[model samples]
Target: MGNIQVALMTVLMFFLLVSLHEWGHYYFARRAGILVREFAIGFGPKLFSIKRGETRYTLRLLPIGGFVRMAGEDPEVVEVQPGQTLAVRVKDNAVTRIYLDRLDERSGVMRGEVKALDLERDLFIQLDVDGEIERYAVHPQALIIARGRDTQIAPIDRQFGHKPVGKRALAIFAGPVMNFLLAFVLFGLALLLQGVPSETSSKVFISGVVPDSIAEQAGVEKDDLVKSINGVVIGGNYEKFVEIINSSAGKQISLVVERKGEDVALKMTPDATTGKIGIYPAGEYRKPSAGETLTYAATSMKDWTGRIFEGFRKLIFGEFKLDDLGGPVKTTQVTVEIAKQGLAQLTSWAAVLSLYLGIFNLLPIPALDGSRLLFLGIEAVRGRPIDPNRESMVHLVGFAMLMLLMIVVTYNDIIGLVRN
Candidate 1:
């Protein structure tokens, strides 16, 4: 593909990831009877939108992120004022004669060819709009309805705040959970498309090495056998070998390798934080069964999740440093580079990206879903909500700090790209 086409596809894939994340929140919120005012797939100015029922679906200018606006964020303050003329259009054709005064709490108006009328509080009413019964939900509080505007706030009955703590937590947790699912799907697709590991992967050998990685610098060549690490003999268990390498990050280690029947002793230092030798273990290719694909996806998710927890554990013990962290610019650069490879490689990259996003959102930092979950957890334990103003202030401060960090990371990413 041309450079322009590559860039477009990259952006589209990124947008897809963001859309899936927001859709998870929107789906759960609606399931719990919460009011979803808007379901938007992007940030910034409105590009195009369509209204259906209570929710307005919008596409925005910025393609990096998206949001699902729930009712509790801006609850409707309803007050009835007498003689307030509210324009209620019962039909599409304005000249056809239908006024707000015709609406009342009495025996409801059964117009010519009446469609559907929600009798309770007369909140939801549907009338024929040019051969179609257009449904409208009117909040009991608001009365003024301008053209193409929803005058009704979400009904008090279905407000998010009124829901039980468990339901609220479910709604909040759904976003990150969906991200994991997205990753699983991507991995599963890659497995099905590119085939699975061959039986030969069981043998200890290097298939590839990352440029400038410890293994490459240590003269670890492709197809070279790894007989031992440090002083311990090599094990048949793949997971154990990976754990040993990762945990030994920032430490000097002696490696004994068999190169064409000759044993070679090599000294290497793993990356300080990642413990990455930048080497991919040898894996042969074979056609995958349905069960194998599913298993691969599940295993990928488990492995990625475990790695995240391991990183956190190391960080807590001061074994990890902040310089290892990456930002969106770095991620975008990775995406562009990955796209240059085949679809299978691209899918693998996306799976890792989704996994990282899901894990990151669960951190107890402010202005994140995890922070909201932490607040909900506290409310569950205390049997009451936290002070709204104080919570809001905390999130505001967190957001500012995050923005500043993003600036620094972006600058670093630019410098790195230029250096490359």
Candidate 2:
């Protein structure tokens, strides 16, 4: 493919990943009865917007990330002001429409007059954008914060905060959990198609040799097919082949080979470091036993999560640079490289990527699921919701730090691309 096509495909993949992640949060929030104001799939200016019911679904120009706006970040201070409160019919196309209520500010008793609606009766609110009734709840709070906060503005209804600790943790963890689930399913399918490794034989064909290494000195060349080592045929049971080579480590081994339809004999000592005569192996697909398949899957997940935590700890302790972090450009380069290897390889890497995303987002960094969970944890410990202004300020700081890291990573990606 051309450079432009490759770039576009990479960008699309990025958007897809971010969109699915954001959708996870949006879905859980709605399911948990939290009001989602805007659901956007990209960053920066909105390219197009479609208003459906109470939410304005938007598509933005920059397809890097997404956000879901919900209520209960600040205490609601409802007061009588000229343009502060508005009473609209239930049919209005606004995310948070509020009915005015008489407030003493000190008494804390909010009273509002609804033309024909009962004040003391339970009201059913249908939360559907397509005009089809899906779910409904009683109207609990009257005043809603479109934006900004004041002493007159009261805390909004229970949001990511009001839920039980376990429920809050589940809602916060849903995004990363979804990512892991995606990885597991994708990997499971790939395993079913490619089969699990039944043996452990290294590729007999030499792909390349380490320069100036023993293999190069011993006359091993790329594409050379090994007929045997020390008169032992290396085929059939792959594990036995590996065992033979491993047993010959640090000892001179006779290699019988065929190159360009010509028979050749080469003698080489296996490197004690990696235990091989420097040959790359072709991938052999083999059917796996039920236990073997489960073992492979479990091991894959463990290795994936292991790398994630390793990276996380390193980043925290200043062992890694922020520029090592990657953005769309780097991700695209990787995606295309994996794609060149064919669909099976691509699917395998996709599973790995999913696991990575799941773990990364679970980190307690600002503007992420983990950070939100951290705030919820604080609320749980303090026995009251955190101050909205303080919480907002903390997240703002995190968002800025995240953006700065992104800029550094993007610059690194561009530099690396130029060098390549």
**1-420 in candidate 2: lDDT tens per residue?**
455655565565566566677778778877776665678988889999876655568999866678776555433334334323233223233212343433333242223332232212343333322333232332443334333321111123335556566766675677787788777766776677666544565545554455567777988776676677789887544455567777887888887777998979988888776677655544345776677666767778888888878887898899987667778688877898765434555667777887888777877888778888888888788888678688888888998898887888888999989988
Tell me the number of clashing residue pairs for each predicted model: 1, 12
lDDT of 1 by residue, 1-420 (tens): 467866987887788788888889999999998878789986679999998877889999856567888877543443223233322433332211223443443142333323554322455655664466555654443333333233444455667777898988898899889889999999999887677666655556665667677898898876677777877776444565677888898998887778889999988888898898888874446789989899999999999889888988997898966656666778887788777655677788888878887888889999888998999999999999998778878888997897787778777777777888
Model 2 misplaced regions, further than 4 Å: 1-16, 73-80, 83-166, 198-280, 287-291, 322-325
Give the candidate number with the greatest lDDT: 1
The per-residue C-alpha lDDT of model 1 at residue 124 equals 60
In model 1, pairs of residues that clash are 198-284
Give candidate 1 regions above 4 Å deviation.
1-5, 75-151, 197-284, 313-324
TM-score of each: 0.64, 0.64
